[model samples]
Target: MILLQVQNVERLFGSDVLFERVNLDVQENSRIALVGRNGVGKSTLIKMIVGLQSPDNGQITKNKNMTIGYLAQDNGLNSSNSIYAEMLTVFNDLKKMEIKMHELENEIATFDHLTQSQTKYDTLLSSYDQLTHNFKEANGYGYESEIRAVLHGFRFYEEDFSTIIGTLSGGQKTRLALAKLLLEKNDLLILDEPTNHLDIETLSWLEGYLQSYSGALLIISHDRYFLDKISKEVYELTSSGTDHYQGNYSFYIQEKAKRFQQKMKQYEKQQEEIEKLEDFVARNIVRASTTKRAQSRRKQLEKINRLERPTDGQQEPHFQFTAERQSGNIVLSVANAFIGHDDKPISGPINIDLRKHQMMAIVGSNGIGKSTLLKSILNKIPLISGEYSFGTNVDTGYYDQELKNLHANKTVLNELWDDHPTTPEKDIRSILGSFLFSGDDVKKVVHNLSGGEKARLLLTKLAFNHDNFLIFDEPTNHLDIDSKEVLEEALLNYNGTVLFISHDRYFINKVATSVLEISKNGSQLYLGDYDYYVDKKEEQLLLAQEENKQTGEIVSKQPEKNSYQLTKEQQRQERKLRREVEDIENQLEQLNAKEEEIQNQMTLPEVYSNLQKSTELQESLKKTQDKISDLEDSWEEKSMELEKFD
Candidate 1:
């Protein structure tokens, strides 16, 4: 069923048209992604759909019975209730039913011993039974468990369930809002930039959760990987119109390119035919012998419908990072480094050896001090302990996510030209032009520039410096997908070494050659992308679980059964349970071995060097790990069951 339909929807801001002729449908359980550049009015469209705003033209129709849940970007829950209590609001109806069931039980018990009329007694009994049935059907019994599961998925634990909403951080509150929305289970969920504050682990969990979600999703996100995982269809919104792609982000990229090429071919073919007709008319129209033929050609030309030249949607910034000079093999080395503020360490005894030409990414959970570490390395903050050294002849450039390096009072052109006063004005303007700052745009004050414009200005400075090494703190924070791709390409082609901090898993996977994970315990290095890091982490966890089993450290928590003789039937049941548990353990052991085999294959030089082979092995490894996980879960359950026979 179509829960919502947007037909030729158009919106305008004064005389300027934001977008026109927009069309889309949200059917039951559909996963739709609305995507475009920064100012293409995606949020405005969402508002119009949700009835927060009205369209200037066309119409939006929504099913009267359907419920819509909208979570705007960074829109946190505002409440005085505890986290668990707030989640319970979604189940108020179930709670009422449960209370009625309890009341019915009490009343029905009264009739158990009373000399009541038969019809009245039967009626009370039936009412009790109905209430009980309704409560059970609504999951009143397991609602708390469901809440716990969702809270855990969002990284909220049992202890944090009682935490006051007002006391939580903004990010935490936003996550809680999303969790609450999920529990509501509305017919349609409209989320805007929902991936903003999530780390890679949380993002992965969210992807899995939404994959099995029962409701439709209309999502706006800049996370390409998230879109690819969640969106079954993508709607590319532009100023002129919206284009629908019947696939994920990757497929959209491929298909969109193919379509643009096809359109170009068609347009060119029509232009050629028009040119021939015009030439025939021009050459013969003045000739007396061919006047009638020329008149017919003119009619054909007049009736032809011309094709507009095709264009790529938006202009993406160009980026190229060139090294000024060669640096030593070891670009940077840090050991026993404690990075944080005012002599208080957030995470440390960090150690890293960044080699030349390696793009190493720093990743950690929120507030774990990834950016602090970057600042410490750059000497913007004093390190509490240890030291870091730069390689010989290394010059560094930095991109601050906060844009703090830019002077607010300076104009865009002056921002770059002032740093290099010796350069000609036109030459400086040319560089700014490459970054999409031209003419009057170059005169905009630094403080007045949008986030993306500031990011480009910073990159422009970085490129101009021709630094041999670069340190970036969340450089992709303000960039659109197209600009991010450009930056990735620049970094991939650059001769300089890079050390950066990012929460963008897709960007990390594309540009990072090494991943340095920061944690409370310490720092660890993984020799691959984000996916490889995840694979390695899971493999280690499985190995640890296996070792614990072998060491007899996973003993049942239950006390031994009271000493007593068992009947023959009881003995048979005990035997069956033990056999199943033993079978699960054996299967787990085999899977563990297979997982190790795949890991060993992944380490082979030839396999690691080949992207396709490496990807295949990773996929195989993931499948094996998933099986082991399932077997482990089964093993735990069966072992607990066998404990009853102990």
Candidate 2:
């Protein structure tokens, strides 16, 4: 069933066209991700779909009975209410129903005095019973518990429930809004950047909850891993219009590339045809010996239609950061680092060694001191205990999501100009243009900038600073896909130490060499990239699943046995199996080579007539193919055995 349909939607802000002739159909139970570069009308489109804004042209048709819940970027939550009271607003209808049902019950009990009143009361009693049944079916009785569980999953503690919304930070308010959306149980849920302020564990919990949710979900987020884990379809909003890709984020990227390649080939072919037509007209026109032929050529030229070049092709930016000097071997050393806020320590006794040119990612649940750790490292916040030291020749540049360093009253150009006074005016303008602030946009006050523009300005400043070390707190928060890639490339080529906090797995996988996980107990170091962390975690999960299956018991904690704990004989067997798999893979490669050789030889038709040589090649191919099949079977068996240890 189609829950909503948008047709020929045209949205405009004054002279600028946000999107034109856009069409989209949202289906029931569909998990759609709206993605695009920043300032490309993704949020505007969301607002139009939810009826918060009307399109200049076209229509949005939603089912009359459908309940739509929208979580705005700012949340718009009242600051005076407590977190619990704010979430309880979702159950207002249920509360009203309960009140009506009680009123009807009292009326029915008093109706015995009059005959007409008794009849009316009987009818009302039947309606009351139906309403009561629905209220119960909606889980109104356990609604508070359900709300509590959702809040907890989002990293909200029991004590936080009574905290005033105004007392909570921006990130807390965003999470509170998300919790309200979850508790509302609307038929359609629209969330904008829901994962922005969440940490890894909270994000993982959200992914699980959304996967199990029955309602349709439409989200706009930059977290590729979250989209890949949750979204069934992706809708890309470009300057041209909306493009649909039927798959997860990774699959969408691959398919989009393939489509672009295909279009490029067709475009080249069309250009060739157009050139040939032009040549024919130029050569034949005005020739006296062939005046009639010239006329014909002219007519054909006039009738020819030129193909428009595809605008879907985008040129990725080239990013390079030139460092003044490399840092010492020990870029940063933390001795018993204690991180906290308001004299309350969240985590302590943390020791760390950050080496030169190393990219480290700090990850943990929300409010679990990930940002506190970064702040302590940057000396932006005072540590309650312990000490940290930076190596010689290390100069640090910080990118905080809150944009605390920016002066609100200054213009964009002035912001950059004030910091780097030696920079030429033309160079400053060019830098601003690269970040998509052009012409009069540079004159806009910093205070008037959106979240995305502020982020871009911060990046522009960072690029110009050319520091030797970088401390980023959710640097990718307001960046679009293109900007994120540009930042990733810059970091990849940077010859400096980096310690950043991010929930974007794709960015971490591309740039981070190690991960630091902060917990209430302490901080644990994982000596690997994002993919390695995922592989290790998945292996642990699978092993736990296997143990539970065998023993019919649940194990909530990780078992204290490593693969190295295997007996000598078992270890020997494992190593032998691994070697056998490697040998089989080598044999398969050889067989593939031989097959390619035979194909190359058989390209000539004359080779087919050489029956003896052909038969010999065919026999050799068959034997190699059989060997490849046997090897594959052996490899599969060995792989299964290896998985047991994992």
Q: Which parts of model 1 are misplaced by more than 4 Å? A: 112-114, 555-646
Tens-digit per-residue lDDT, 143-237, candidate 2: 87787778877766677789999988787788887888888888999999888777776786687678768899999988887887778778898
Span of 10 residues, lowest total lDDT, candidate 1: 556-565
How high a TM-score does candidate 1 get? Answer: 0.84
Clashes of each: 0, 0
Candidate 2: deviation at residue 6, Å?
A: 0.8
Estimate TM-scores for all models: 0.84, 0.75
Task: Give the winner by lDDT.
Answer: 1
Per-residue alpha-carbon lDDT of model 1 for 421-531, expressed as tens digits? 999999999888888888899989999999889999999999999999999999988898889989999999999999999888889999999999998766999999987
lDDT of 2: 0.81
